[model samples]
Target: MKLKLIFLLTASILAFTGCNNFETLNTDPARSSETQPEFLLGNAEKRASDLLYDTYFNGRIGMELSQYWMGTDKTSDGRFLFTNDGLWSGMYAGPLMDLQEIQNYYDRHPEETNPNILAVSEILKSWIFHILTDVYVDIPYTQALKGDVIPQPVFDKGKDVYSALLVSLKKQIDVLSNPGTMAIRGDVVANGSAAQWVRIANALRMRIAMRMADAQPAEAKAIIEDAVKNTMVSVAQDAFFPYNVATVTNRFPYNDVDRPLVEFAVTSTLVTYLQSVNDPRLPIFARPDETNGKYIGKVYGTEANAPTMIGLSKPGVMAYSGSAKGYMITYAEVAFLKAEAAARGMAVGSASAEELYKEAVTASMTQWGVTDAKVVATYLEGVPYKGGTWKNVIGTQKWLALYMQGIQSWMERLRLDPKKPNGEVLFIPPASGSLDPEVTDVPKRLKYPSSSRAANAINSEQAAKSIGGDTQATKNWWDTL
Candidate 1:
């Protein structure tokens, strides 16, 4: 059944060649339109996870932008020239389209519609849209997924899209909150647990709220307060997609023989911070530098005199292993969100900012296998919250905890220090010399893909104008001081 489902999902995704005609092409007679909701849901989950893992989370640009890893090649991603073609297509043509198909199925067979399936689909849809808007800003939202019905969907403003997504998430939460006779199936991420789905929904809500902190303070505060009251309160509830080496296609993208060894190494920013604090996860995160037998990172974006691969730390097993889980959102991130909210004097939960911050650190350590009680305690004592402003303290630790999840790490860094031309406060290594003179700073957002421009030219142009300009340096609505 699982194999059959995977096949159907793959077939469905392949049927849609372009975003402009996804809906029409997806419903062709040759395609398996009779695919079950469970299968569609499972496929959407896997494809979405893979896109995040392969195209964004583990992608070179994201890692380099977040300063988690540096490219050893002369054409290092540190130069900041990038496009969003893979991401835009993956979300729209794969997960989002599959989700819409599932919705269509339920609509046609209303009696057979499982609330659990529908709710999960909605949650996944919200997640993909969140990534889309956060990365590109002002994307096609309400009118998208209609195919021939609305071939040229107008782009929605980033803030308006965010507002709509929060509402959609709430409706999904309501559906999941109520009991239903049918059980959720084909749930590779959360194992068909409605309770876990609820937690994920709430955790995602908290994330969106935090993103809106500077731009939409009152709304952010209210949403976060409610989210904290209901979200995942511990490490066990993290939403992660587990990969199976047995399934060749499902293996981690970086687990290949050549890529891990040749292309990547840990960045100086990450290694320096971990070493400064005597972080135990250093060994776990990176292999010892081959030449010196000590962990060392290559300077990010430097061209002339960068460290050679042999002298720098390569990604450890956790990063490059086929079995490494694709983390969607984690308990550690939730704790930090609550900590940040508390620091902002928002009513999140009973825990104080210091208390939540400590828990977040512990959760991150525990996730990375630093579980010894005494060791964790000692580490916590060393990094305890001091007196004054909590911004740097929370921001720096959050950056460390969100190592492999580069997309989120980039988003958090932008949120913490939005106005800075260079991320000086967050310790993001600046790009220089090799960087294009036209590119004055690290990109605030990705440019609309060439595919998007060709397929939906008018709408894309409007989107760019709405967000100030279409350039990478153009800041999104939420990325404000």
Candidate 2:
């Protein structure tokens, strides 16, 4: 009798739960979940989407600090690197915190198993792991985020983190492909649809695998092939978050800010690459330097007289415009990776590497609103063509797409064409902060945040001891390639 009563009450409330605020407070205690599993699932989906936007704050901002633009002034004591303490706070504190919680909750309950949340969380995990492994290089992971249960987390080597992420992603994608699907009540791309989320998950697998190129070429090639079969082969299938004017929640971060006053200016290396290739995407990606037509970027060490920009005084509104959701992965990036793999005779899809290379180049230009047939024709015509200049073709495209994003463009400068090294370098130098140049062919890795040394002294010391050579000069495990 009691069970019957509980079941009846639960069904009644689930019917009306949507009419009320999404909070489960109104739900009948005994039968709420059974009565309306979809409602709880819907609310969870909403929370997951919220997680994606927060990354734009942490990750996107770092990219901006990289070389896309110069800062208005020093962001951190390590101004040379535009070393924002916020990067850790934002990446670890925000996106990571929620992800760790959500994943654990998902693991225990295993209820929200649809592709959207699965893909979303899986992709989010990949990025979070990427950020930590790439920047901090051997920070906590193996025992990290065990939550209150296990407080002192052990720092796993970066290669371990990458391997673990790949395995986890591969498993989840397989389960998602033909398993009991979750109830997706909200607008969740990764979870809401199986095909799309699978695509994203596969793309992420390829990405992380590519990072392992130097350390585990065989493993990397296998993973890349696995991903290529199901991943982003064309722009129609890129995993992107598009910002809409109607939705202020999704607007691009730079929409309301004064572009010129923000202190971040376009860098010389970037401008030179853009101008050299005569890429039309330059005008679309950056505002013109009104003072002198030639792109004038300020060096990072400048104490005064910042570079000039046009419409500096112009008032701009945050009306539905230029802002887009942060990019998790793009078709161009995948294509470039394939091109590299092809150059090395790695496993990939049907097209010859050269064919894929041209496709990748055109896809990048198209994304930037460069619709001029002539420009497209010239880019394809290979006028900027220099023989054996694979770096010229692939590196520039990679850099161009990663604008305002952070070290990715600069990273290409380091990695592309590792065989025949080039004298060219790309980086966002330390501004009035570093005593001298990075002294590396490229900016290697960020300095450990000052707070790490002060606040988390004991644990950080252990990390520094374990990771070894934790300096800007220290090469990350993945960067070995």
Candidate 3:
């Protein structure tokens, strides 16, 4: 009892020293520590570390499975070791959960509202909602983050979520504009300031608004225009996270598994595109095979064909980077969005979609370390978007720009699929031998996490009744395009 008292006394001294600094200290929802503004900002940092992980899985995990990319695929489930659920809870539980909790804390302590927390939440929330929409189309949004106070939150129409995000992004951008917003105070990101936060928030708004192209083209145009009128002009303001081996959660484990259980490699389809374009990014994007010394690509489900040597997996095919970075919105993505919006007749700075396509391609190459001016010049030889349909113009430009970025790439294709979901896929990834690739197309949506169904059984039952079956194939609003 004396030791406990001593510990309490020490804490009180420190708390008292810091107490005067606080405008108003409040009781945190679950924390016994009297959280002042600094603590709340520190909490934002802790959450940012967690939020960084969201990019790898929700943003990028399922995306690899959807399209034919240069490297990695287990989502097919043919031979790729990862099961559907393995793909399900990849990173959502960690980061998404923490973000919700932080919001709850903020809600309880309104005085703690500062530029960093407000802006970070607004920007990251758009990302969270974007990932959820990509997977399920519609989800609980109008009533989200309510915790036990609201046990059963109805799913918002996907369109509604997009609208809500648009408002949040705009509001938060203004909050982060003040120089003193995070200055002379605690900070989450080391080099982050209020201006940087606004840039990211605005850029993300541009991306989100463009996502509504098909479902609400006119609305998409208005939002895009608002963004271009007030948008980011460089990659420095990019809202991205740096990843390293020690920061494993911030990186995608698909390409960095610890043991030798799952075996998948680069996709042949992507290899062909890289080679055909003679794109310099191929080297940076994919690692060469150590055995054959050839750039070998693997079929999604059939990663282990060493014995057969037909689209087989090799040990050193993929060049793993322990310190690789995760991408959020960047200049490359913005260019591509512009290209896409232009294709759909969304005017911005009077640049045509075709013009934007060329610019986007060049910008993307530059962002991926494609520096040599001559090499860049040569890579731009191909005619930009010779095809007329938005699918060919916007879709193809986006495909190249979104390499390894995640669900953003897959959604582009989903957006352009035939109105009735019947069309010829130009880049049909090498199919999972398990599924008769000719017959069954890749799924467009993921089933809900089994745990959610098991624990929230009552809610799950209602969801099933409302949405026909919570299967992996249910198309979300954007995917249903």
Candidate 4:
């Protein structure tokens, strides 16, 4: 008993002593205090993919605007009634924030920064900002992502933003050309390959330059000439977000089991056009109607006289296989851009406009798993290039190639034919009866979020005015036509 009492008293004293420095002794060795740029880069990529490939934003809002698909149960988006505030806030607070953090880290620790990683970050940031300015017309670019430093960043003009982005992309191309020793880590899109990043950077520069072709002709011409001299993405090196079937979070948006399948159906406009041209991608794009043994698409945005859902074709099953790749940009699109540049008499190599156009169509067919040469030839013959109508031909083909990639398709429409000239516009507007009285045609840009207006009313109003009242019908700077 006496020995037991002494032992207990000694242990109590030791425990009291240990408590004095318990925090230092109990620290987790594996825990990291610093931000991991690698993990953050992957996260930023995923978030951007999610925003772009999301069922609501890309499908209902963008695809509907481009007339690729129409909402069945929910017709608001199809009617151009969507506010798109969530998309705006999501981009700024989500992926953009993550990317900004990565850049900020590198800027602060210049000694530890890798040129390859920095180049990758800049490329992605440009792409995201490209989408933003294209959608909103003008956004807080210069002072954006500064967190509390500039709470109410003034909205920059779309044209100015484009200029800055082009310069930044040019700088990145140089950085990537002579990459540093540090390897990119946690990369899900390009797998940490600097070669692939270089191609993407060059491709983006060309795309941006081409967008400014009409508005800033001389400058755009110079940029395109330089970009064409550099290496661009090949068909095998196309950028895509690879979704997996392992979990709800990783699965393709269309394949999300939690969401109902009957919310949308393929648009009749797309189905009819494909059928008219006898395009081989039709079957891959949509499934035959259930009641009728035919590919019958639903008329776009018709609520009063809307057809029953029983005989309407839904999007194809292959597209929602739970692992469909979320395409960011494709070789076909780049080829089409080259074709356009050539058509415009810009120096885009020795390939003629006709040859480039055919190549683009072939690339697009191949991308959609339709590589049969005879079928593609037949389709190309049906839609042969017309020198006098190169704009319509290229615009129409590009629109078709960008199916299901709604935002890109819609943006391309604005760029190609903002005025929606008769027989020239690439997109089909909603049925006359279905058209919302508030907007006369398909939306060209999304309005600023209400939250933005409420929180930063001065800046929001200034941006709205800068973009010509922030109405859906307002044209972006790139939509010069």
- TM-score of every prediction relative to native: 0.89, 0.77, 0.77, 0.91
Cα lDDT, model 2, residue 342: 79
For candidate 4, the C-alpha RMSD (Å) to the true structure equals 3.5
Could you give the C-alpha RMSD of every candidate to the true structure, in order shown?
Answer: 9.5, 8.1, 7.5, 3.5
lDDT, candidate 1, at 264: 78
> What is candidate 1's TM-score against the reference?
0.89
TM-score of 3: 0.77
For model 2, how does the per-residue alpha-carbon lDDT over 1-481 read when each residue is reduced to its tens digit?
A: 9999999999889867766765666777776243133343333333333443333333234443345544434433224344345455455555566556555555666764345454455555666677667777776677666647765566677778888888888877886677455543343334366667677788778777776787788999888877888877677776555555566655554454333334445555456656766767666655555655545554543455332334221111221144654566778888888887776678687787778777777787766666677778787775332336665556656666665445455445445532211435445455555532543233455655676566556776776766665566667776664
Off by over 4 Å in 4: 1-27, 107-111, 256-260, 304-308, 418-426, 432-438
Worst 10 residues of 3 by lDDT: 417-426
- In the range 417-446, model 4's lDDT, one tens digit per residue, is 622112543345576443556576678788
Give the alpha carbon lDDT tens digit for every residue of 1-481 in model 3. Answer: 9999999999999889778856445545466654454444444444444443342443234445544442343333432222445333433444455556656666788776555565665566676677776666656677665656776566676678888888888887676665463552444442556666676676777877766666676787888877876665665655555555675654433445464422335566556666765777677666566556677666444434443333433323222444444566678778777777766666777877767777777777777777677876676665346535646655655676666565666666666642211223445533544343222455566666676577567766676656666665566654445
Q: Global CA lDDT of candidate 2, please? A: 0.58
* Clash-forming residue pairs, model 3: 60-406, 70-266, 70-267, 71-266, 137-476
* Candidate 1 residue lDDT tens string, 1-481: 9999999998887765566687875687777658889899899988888888884345676777788887775444677755335789878999899999988898899988888888888899998899899999999999999996998899999999899989988898898888477789888889998888888998999999899999999999999888777888778888898887778788866675344455777878788878877888999888887778998887777663443577788877788878888889999999999898999999876778999899999999989989998998888877777535588778888888898898888888788852211224445445454354455546788889898899899999998999988887788888884
lDDT of candidate 1 at residue 234, scale 0 to 100: 79
lDDT of predicted model 4: 0.82
lDDT of 1: 0.82
